[model samples]
Target: MTEDFYCDEVLSDKIQVRKVLETDNVLAYYHTKPFWPVHVVAIPKKHIPSLITLEESDNELLLELLRVIKKVATMVTEENGACRVITNLGDYQDSKHLHWHIVSGEPLKQLFNERLQ
Candidate 1:
């Protein structure tokens, strides 16, 4: 897999995603493999390395992406009562792409199952 899973898979259509919202510059969808009960991912359709890498020229694109994220976040929060918006950075980031996760409820996967035992 590439460092940018979003570009290599999701954007490339190698992995299909169920879309939640879409705009000319943004795409929001249900995570292919959800980590939470209510999990959605919002990303710019165009490939952006990461949030911190965005340049001043990308202001409009950034605004559009944020609008989509806000819409998705509101939907999740209204339906689930609460939600969390998250974005990883640097080494903590699994995929080196500008993506935001709008999630609700406790984790569905036992990601640290082995470590806890």
Candidate 2:
């Protein structure tokens, strides 16, 4: 995958995503490859690399992104009774673009279970 999948693929339209919520500077969509039964990804429309890379200029954008994430998380939690909000960084991040995942239901892979145990 490219370093910035969200910018190079999803945002650029090279890959299509089912959008859950969208504003001028943010987008919440169903993950192209989901890790959980109900997995949604929220990202800033503008490239921000990673959470650690966020600059002071990005404060407003971050707030907007969080707002979208909160809405998506609330929807998932209301339906599923519970959900998780997750983000990865450094080596754990597959895609460098800043993004948050709102997910519900058991993890589809045993790796997550093994790590938790």
Candidate 3:
């Protein structure tokens, strides 16, 4: 995988994604490869490497991203009764892009096991 799949693939149109929500600066979409039964990814349209890399100027963007996440999470939770909002950092971050996952239901154990290896 490339260092920034969001930029190199999704944003660039190299890979197509089913969008859940989209604004000028934020995008929420179904994960290309989902780990949970209901997994949606929200990201800033601009390239921000990761959460830790966000600058003061990015505060508005961050809020917009969170708003989209909240909407997606709410939709999932209303249907599933519960959901999780997750983000990975440092070594846990596989894509190196600032993204939040809104998911519900038990994770797919097979996907977790495969990623561990």
TM-score of each: 0.90, 0.92, 0.91
Top-lDDT structure, candidate number: 2
109 Cα displacement, candidate 1 (Å): 3.0
What root-mean-square deviation over C-alphas does model 2 reach? 3.3
Write down the RMSD of all candidates, one decimal each.
2.5, 3.3, 3.4
Error of 1 at 88 (Å): 0.7
By TM-score, how accurate is candidate 1? 0.90
Pick out the ten consecutive residues of candidate 2 with the lowest summed lDDT. Answer: 107-116
Taking the tens digit of each residue's C-alpha lDDT, what string does model 3 give over 43-71?
Answer: 99999989999999999999899889888
User: 54-73 in candidate 2: lDDT tens per residue?
Assistant: 99999999999999999999
Sorted by lDDT, highest first, which candidate order results?
A: 2, 3, 1
Model 2 residue runs over 4 Å out of place are: 111-117
Better model by lDDT, 2 or 3?
A: 2
Least well predicted 10-residue stretch by lDDT in candidate 1: 108-117
lDDT of 1 by residue, 34-62 (tens): 99989899989888888899999999999
lDDT of 2 at 22: 98
Candidate 3 weakest lDDT stretch, 10 residues: 105-114
